[model samples]
Target: MAVEFMHPDGLLQQSDYAPVAVGTGSRLMLLAGQAGVTPDFKPAAPDLAGQVHAALRNIIIGVRGAGGDVGDLARLTFYIVDWVPEKWDEVLAGIARAQQAEGLPAPTPPITIIGVQALFTPDFVVEIEATAVLD
Candidate 1:
């Protein structure tokens, strides 16, 4: 892997993800925001947790489609609608489940979560975009 994640001294080292990611791969993949909607254009899951899980899984699918894996991911940006601090645990849990199902280790990519008022569809609670580098 040409991507390295670092948590320098004096930086917060929470297990959720690394705060910094340096990638030196020759190929880069930029994925569009993946929503919770399924292939049939229907909601994959109705609840926030479910949408979060589906969106994460979709990100994995995108990475793999680009001939990359989770470890190749350098960054992730999550856009959430009506996001609430209280639901963070649920979101984390959904991410964990998606990672496990994909046979991926804990993500080390730099992650950013943004709260927004809405999305393309009224049912979409979350959307995620991923950037990956392939060696």
Candidate 2:
């Protein structure tokens, strides 16, 4: 498996994702956005940290269902309702727990966390998306 860093003439390398991700001879999986919302579309937890944890759990389930484990994950994007420097540690710890459950090694996937005003539901604190590449 291979991941290439690509940059075009007019794009900012750090902030912009590649226009296309090419993975030759490797299986690719695109997962849907997973939030803290339960099966009935209710928030699992009103608190930000709890919601983040729930969303990560949902992501793991989705990955397993797709025949790919967390170790196969190459990139993850997180969208949060409100982000502050004080919350970084909580976010990192949550991610570490998720990675550990999947038996992934250290130096986790490239992650992008974005802060937004709100999500589809007022109670939803975080939403996460994942991309996996399996050998």
Candidate 3:
């Protein structure tokens, strides 16, 4: 499997995506947007960080179910409701923990975080979407 990271700069890329991700894989899994909702469809947490962690966990499970691993993740997009400057550090730390749990390297896949007014659910604070290549 070949993994290519586009726009290697540390500063977040402002484009809709980092760069075109090409993979010679027969199976491609497109995971649905995962929120903090749990197995029982209950909000896993009330805070942003907790919700972020839970969402990432759910995403990993989805990837595994599709015969893929975190390493196969090619792109990640995040939608955050009510983003705040004071919470930046906490958010980054939570992301680090999530990547660690997946046994993935630091500065994981190309990511985009957008602040929105609200999500489909009132209790949801964050949602994560991932695209993976299962080669």
The local distance difference test score of each candidate is 0.83, 0.70, 0.75
Q: How displaced is residue 34 in candidate 2, in Å?
A: 0.8
lDDT by residue (tens digit), candidate 2, 16-70: 2343343442788878879977889899877776676778788778877877666
lDDT of 1 by residue, 1-135 (tens): 768888889999798888988889999899999997798878898887788778878888888888887788889898989878887887887787777776545754788889999999898888989888888
**TM-score of each predicted structure versus truth:** 0.92, 0.73, 0.80
Stretches of candidate 2 exceeding 4 Å from the true structure: 1-25, 100-105
In candidate 2, which residue pairs get closer than 3 Å at backbone N, Cα or C atoms, i.e. clash? none
Best by lDDT: 1
Clashes of 3: 0
Q: In candidate 1, how many Å is residue 78 off?
A: 0.7
TM-score of candidate 1 relative to the true fold: 0.92
In the range 1-135, model 3's lDDT, one tens digit per residue, is 434556656755644334545655667778888997889988988887778778888988998898877777787788888877686665676576686775543556777788889998889988889888887
Task: Indicate whether candidate 2 or candidate 3 has the larger lDDT.
Answer: 3
Candidate 1 segments exceeding 4 Å error: none
